[model samples]
Target: MKQNIYNFFLMKYSREKIALLISGKASFIALFSLIIIFSFLADKFFSLSNLTNILDLSAILLLTSTAMTFILMLGSIDLSVEGIAGLTGVVGALMVKNFSNSNDYGLLSIIICILLGAIFGLLNGIIFTKLKIPSFMTTLGLGAVASGVCILSTRGYPVIITDQTIRGLAHIKLLGGVIPLLFVIAITINLLIWFVSERTILGRHVIAIGGDEAIAKDLGIKINLVKIMVFAISGAIFGLAGMLLVAKLGAGDIRNPYGLLFDSIAAPLIGGIAITGGIGKIPHAAIGAITLTILRNGMVLLGINPYIQQSVVGTIIILTVAITIERKKIGVIK
Candidate 1:
């Protein structure tokens, strides 16, 4: 019995398990370490109000990053998030009782925005799979189109959302105002994605396809269907994030999602998700978003220049990608 227990402990600490542990917790470890450092350095960094602000800001990025995780898991990329988000925000606002429109669709506007996002995503999938377009180029073009649509819808003007109920939802708080309702909603969405990724056959297929698309195709997996569904789901999430952003800001501007594309891409990449694909968790992306939010918030508190902060984030992305990406799998750097 003693020998068996010792052997079990040894196996638990084996190289494979050790590597898995490191890979799984690397982002989390970095997050906590940064928190500690910032707490010691900035006088107000660890305050409850500041922490709540971080969580609130993290909610939007968390939603977008979660969506991106699905596409990344399939060894594909979605550059259309910002554009889709901007389009949905403008459309949703216009449909609701807002400054620019007399129509009052209420909850239906939200549904329509999400559906619009899904449609665009489906189109992306169809173009990529049927037309044989590279995902990067296809998504980039689609993004541009979506941004154009947003601009046309607003005529280069911002639309103020005056619906009290929608704005109230954004301001709602729980746990003595330490947690925003929007953040709670974002967390719930993340949990659902995690469940799907971990428990469903569709999720397994995504990983298998990412691991080896040729083998997955040969094995009778419906590659096009899966890719399309993933993109649609991602687009819907992006739409929801956009709607939430509108509520938070009380306006729908064409430029609302301008900087989100890079942040969404960076979060998953920093969270140990392979750029080559096939290895990552949904929760990892959320943690990465939180880590980034904390970093940015701490920097602001410490009086760091915003441009310098962007440079630091860019540097971190380069370093993390270099270390975490599966270089052995790709024969060529390009």
Candidate 2:
């Protein structure tokens, strides 16, 4: 026992291990730091109501950011997130008991919306791979297409949900209303995705491809399939988020999911996922989501200007990416 204890302490610590350890905790550190600063800056920051608000606000952002993390890990960006979310929210609204339609699909509506998101993602993957288009261009074009569809469907009007059961789902609370059911659902799903990313072949391939696509291709990795799966998975999560958004807002508008794209991307990046790709964890996205939520929530509590808040978030993104980026690996710029 004495020998074992000594050996454990004597174990050599490599620089790589140290670096990884620090990288993994960077987001947590940022989250804690924000909490501490906010607690001091805003009297209500640490209150139960405020904390609950932060968690509730984080639900959708958490789901979207976690999905975005995988896309970033694949060295790709999904500009279609906002458009897909808007479209899916509208679809979910229209399909459910809504003022715009008599259709009351209930849970089935959610499933179709999620599946629609997956189909869009699959299309994005196919176009990106088979058509040899850059992910940026393909996703951007698809996003615009989605937005157009959304506008056409809405015809410049909002769809108010009339389904009491569906709307009530968002308002359901646990622990005497201290915790929201929607946030719990988001956390559960995030855990599932984290497991997939850490323990599955697809997840491993995503990291490998992002790290070095040339080597991954040479080593028998199905690059296209992995990329497609990642995007599809993200799309499905985005769909779920859209449905929940509709439930919470009791209406669906093209602008319902406004700022989601920015929040999703910023959360992952702020959490230590490199924009350049191939180096981060799913949990980091969750942490980043909470951090961003708290930052915004605290700002509002402190009476900060809404416009300046946007600037702060933008600056944080730029700074975090600069700090965590794998600059040595990316030797050239276009």
Residue pairs clashing in model 1 are none
Let me know the TM-score candidate 1 reaches against the reference structure.
0.93
* CA lDDT scores, all candidates in order: 0.84, 0.85
Model 2 lDDT at residue 241? 85
Best by lDDT: 2
- Each candidate's TM vs. the true structure? 0.93, 0.93
Worst 10 residues of 2 by lDDT: 5-14
Error of 1 at 44 (Å): 0.8
RMSD of 1: 5.3
Residue 43 miss distance in model 1 (angstroms): 0.9
For residues 76-125, write the lDDT of model 1, one tens digit per residue.
99999999999999888887779776888877877888899889899888
